[model samples]
Target: MGMIGKYARLTPGELQQILGDPALGHRLVEAMGEDEEDGRRLDVDKAWHAMSFFLDRLGFPVEVVFGEQEVAGAPDWGYGPPRYLPPAQVRVAAEGLARIDGATLTGAASRQELFEAGIYPDSIWTRDEDALAYVWAHYDSLVAFMTTAALAGDAVVTWIS
Candidate 1:
């Protein structure tokens, strides 16, 4: 299955709605390319790229919070080479969500730790049943995919599914 298919099923319209920024949408469209012959489901590579782009432009400070052990000169997230986006960007996105929602982090964990936890560095705890349920149902899948991709040398941006 494609990446987005693994988590909460989102129609193209739903994706467009969630990705409310027009510029980001346009960027995603460009990343997806103009292949009219294929239906509009985002290609895996394009979807990954678009996700990264969306995170970078989403009006949050993605400052490079240092990882536990700064592997000297190791490419962030260890995405070996020929990557479309920065792996740090993905961590920033993930942690950014937690930060936004007042979720307390046990200090900054490496991308690996966040991956293993299957949650953002900042945890999610909410009283709103619907919102909490939605997060519980889908966040892990999203985090897992991103973590796996990063570990396997693919550029992936962290985001809520």
Candidate 2:
């Protein structure tokens, strides 16, 4: 599988527990797999890097796309251990994401820009409109995911798989 990005909303207590025992992070990843349609989880597919570039171009901190805290000892599903954003940071990220209108998201980065930035999974970015559409759709999903996590006062755990 390619480097798909996954996000799961976690309760504050859940975050604390995971921090104390990083292996618990695996359970969250498994739970995400069990029910992808579950509101608590989001799979951004292969559009992660392009989404990151666009969001960064829109002025949101890169951490909002990746994460802040690394969960030491968490299983490396693919890229690395899961990283997370606390509830406070989630709220801030949600605010920034919410401010991004569709037009801005679509126009922030051109295909050439994405290619030049050396975004991951390079082959996909060569497809012109399809590539942009893929990234836009996933970015929209991400905005909704962060917004919901913030409203629920939950932290967000992100991992690449």
Candidate 3:
């Protein structure tokens, strides 16, 4: 299956399950290249990639979550948001989200702008307007979840499989 990016407002208990599992525990460390523990990978939703690329253009390196490994390395499971995020990181990201204008994002002008910026991958470009609109639709909720997690000083975990 193609990768799908997703995140949730994780509770501390949910985070514990992830941190307690060795496969998941050291994921953030691995992603950030803090060590060579041998188990961590990360991928955002393909749609989210465009947003990340856009952010990179603005010089804001935002790595919201990190992990492409199965949750706990389970054979048939998915990735979960790693329990990581300094309060400052969360604050910065939440503040950055204020720049998202939902109406403007889904409008024709934004589509043209994104296309011009060359941020979209073929997965989105192939479907034309529909996929683009779909990304925006989900983005609204994605930002909301991230914002909520930030407000509570919690991490927004994701399971992209």
Q: Sort by lDDT, best first: what order?
A: 2, 3, 1
| lDDT tens digits, residue span 1-161, model 2 | 87888888999999999999999778755766747577888888888887777777766764866799888778886788889999999999999888886568768567777778799878776775688877778888988999999999999999888
Q: Model 2 Cα displacement at 71 (Å)?
A: 0.8
Q: Which scores higher on lDDT, 1 or 2?
A: 2
Using all chains and alpha carbons, the TM-scores for the candidates as numbered come to 0.27, 0.90, 0.56
Deviation (Å) of 111 in candidate 3:
6.8
RMSD of each: 15.5, 1.7, 9.2
> How do the residues 31-137 of candidate 3 rate in per-residue lDDT, one tens digit apiece?
44522122122234567655555445555545653422234443332444333444456667677765665454444434556666675464456447676666666
TM-score ranking of the models: 2, 3, 1
For model 2, the superposed segments whose C-alpha errors exceed 4 Å read 106-108
Residue pairs clashing in model 3 are 41-68, 79-159, 81-157, 81-158
Q: lDDT of all predictions, in order shown?
A: 0.33, 0.82, 0.52
Best by TM-score: 2
RMSD of 1: 15.5
Model 3 per-residue lDDT at 41: 25
> Which of candidates 1 and 3 reaches a greater TM-score?
3
lDDT-best of 1 and 3? 3
